[model samples]
Target: MGDIIRVRGLEKRYGEVRALDGLDLTVPEGTVLGLLGPNGAGKTTAVRVITTLLRPDAGTAEVAGIDVLADPMEVRRRIGLSGQYAAVDEHLTGRENLEMVGRLYGFPRARARARAGELLERFDLADAGDRPSKTYSGGMRRRLDLAGALVAAPPVLVLDEPTTGLDPRSRIQMWEVIRELVSGGTSLLLTTQYLEEADRLADEIVVIDAGRAIARGTADQLKRQTGGERVQLVLADVADRDRTRVLLGEVCRSDVRDGETERELAAPAEGAATLMEVLRRLEEEGIAVLDIGLRRPTLDDVFLTLTGHGAEAPGTARTEEPAR
Candidate 1:
């Protein structure tokens, strides 16, 4: 399928900071493109540029064949955007919020009402449709905001960190909603710092750092670049850390690295054979581990290898321009 969203050499600067530097990305029709990056990595900047919320210093962006810079109004009409925060009015009921969006898009009153009702049902918000959004939970508000974006039923959907602050269950619910949209042929561009989110949702992944596209591929392709399985260890005692590292270094293909906790460590392994060897060696030394497993290289490994740092939290990077 042809690309429904295309960006070439897109650049945006904030004084001395370059939010987007010669970045290029595309989303195939009816496919999901996950713009994976740490906070302040220009993911949001690129989204703003593509969605026509902000002008780029230099570059070309198109949505549904319309030039973003040349005819932004036309471009806007063909795409829907759900930004980082739920952009719903607390005073309005969920149904009213969606209907307002429909009216803004120039739908007549009858059609707007009908569309709002349809979306409330689609997003599983019909039960809370008439409640003031301030009374809804965080997830409910988010679903309502996304429903508002779909009021026009645009062909392309842009979600900027859609599940950033959601609880696990809420995030999964949002994923289901997104999956259903894609199944019905909606093209998606999803920006997120969550590795699992990208691995689970994206058809293609783009890894960006400091406003540049560093890597682009499917999740498996990117994982392959890191190579081999990772043998993860959770030591029974923190005192065994050094000894565990020494043991891991002997059998692992690469140096053992500290995990999230002091008791945890990970190293690259050849495969199941390597895992078995490590197990035997550890057992022989009488070293104990709370957990041990061999798993394929994850997107986190790919990010660490490519960027030399883990994904930053949302809002840690100063990538946006001040209000104009």
Candidate 2:
């Protein structure tokens, strides 16, 4: 499949702040691209530019083979966008909000109403379809906003932090919906601070820092960069710590490191084979472990190692601001 969304040398500046500096990325048709970054990393800015919400200072963006700058209206017609915050009319019923979006896209009144009903059902808002969105919970509002973005069933969908404030159950529901969309051949560009969300939904990931593409790969490929996998254990007795360390040191790829708690220790391992080796040694030595597990590096590890901070770290927000 070809790229449905392509950007090159995209630059956007908020006065002295380069919100997107030489940023580049692509989303293959029928695939999801997760855009990850810490605060002030230009993720939202890049979304705004591609969605035609904001003009970039320089460079190019295209959606579905149409230049975003040269044919923005056509691009808009081919892509659906859900921004950081829920963009719903508080006074309007859930059905009305989606119907309004369809109407704005030029769907006839009857067709708009039908489309809205379909989306309400698909997003699990059918029962509350007639209630004003202001009465909805945070998760409901987010679902409503996402439903609105799909009223026209555009080929390319851009979701910016779609489940940012959702409860765990609600977040999982959204992931299911996104996965369904991709399965039906919809291309997606998702920007998120939730590592697990990206790990679950994105076919590939792009990590941006200070407005540039710093890392790009599949979840496992990225995780491998932060030291692959590790064998971790908690000793039943603190006295076994030194021996456990020595035993692990003999088989581990790297030196053992203290885990989060006093009795816990972790060491890099090749994979399941190393885990088995550690277990066999512990059994022979009579050292008991309260817990033992082998785990691959997570996106959190990749984020910290690459960006020098967590994904949700507090700092300058890179959201849109009045040019000063």
Candidate 3:
């Protein structure tokens, strides 16, 4: 499949504040590309530019062979977008909101009505189809908005934090919905702050910071790039902390990490072999273990490594550029 969304040298600025500075991205057909960043790293700005909702101050974006700047209408026709907030109409019934989207996209009245029903069913909003969207839960309303985006059955989909503010159950439901859509061969560009979400749904991930692309690769590749493995042990008795630490360091041939918690001791574990060796030695030394496991580097590690901040850290809004 070809690149359905292509962006190069994209730039957007609000006076002295740069929302996007020489940003570049690409999403191939039938794949989900996760866009991750700190609160103001231009992920939302990039989505707007690709969806033709915001004009870029520089560079080019092409969606499904249509240049977003020169022919945004054509690009819009080939793509669907669900933004950070649910854009459903409060006064409108869930069905009506989707039907309106279909009508706006030029579907015939009968087809629009039918498409609305199909989307409501597909998104698991069928039971609430006749109710005013204002009466729906946050997840229901988000599903309605996503259904509205799909009313025209566009080949490419762009979602910006679609699961934000959703409860765990709702987030999982949304993930199932997204998987179903992608299974049908729709290419997707997803911008999300949830590291686990990206880990589950993305075929590739792009991490941006300070308005520039900082890292791009598959989840595992990025994890490997971040560094190696670590083993965490919960000691039944914290008295042996020093012994455990020294044993782990000797086994893994490196220093151990500390201070997160008193009972939990963490150390670098090069691989399963090192972990096994540590376990054997700890047993010999009469160390009590509550729990132990070797874990590879996670996306959170990658984010902190590349951006110098964790994604869940409190973020100051980028006030210079209002989110469009």
For all predicted structures, in order, the TM-scores are 0.85, 0.83, 0.84
Regions of model 3 farther than 4 Å from truth: 233-242, 250-255, 258-265, 268-299, 312-324
- lDDT of residue 198 for candidate 2: 81
> Please, what are the lDDT tens digits per residue for candidate 3 over residues 169-235?
9999999999888989899999987667887899999988768888999877776666557787888
**What is the lDDT for 2 in model 1?**
87
C-alpha lDDT of all candidate models, in order: 0.86, 0.86, 0.84
True-structure RMSD for candidate 2: 6.3
For model 2, the local distance difference test gives 0.86
lDDT string for model 1 (1-324, tens) is 789999999999999999999999989899999999878889999999999989999989999888999999999899898967438999999999999999999999999999999999989999999999999998888898899889999999999999999999999999988888888989999999877789889999999888888999988788777664789889998898898899898887567777777898888877788889999999999999999999775545665667555464432433432110
lDDT of 3: 0.84
Candidate order by TM-score, decreasing, is 1, 3, 2
Name the top TM-score candidate. Answer: 1
Point out the higher-scoring one by lDDT: 2 or 3. Answer: 2
Clashes of each: 0, 0, 0
Residue pair clashes in candidate 2: none
| Residue-pair clashes, model 2 | 0
Q: How far is candidate 1 from the true structure (C-alpha RMSD, Å)?
A: 6.1
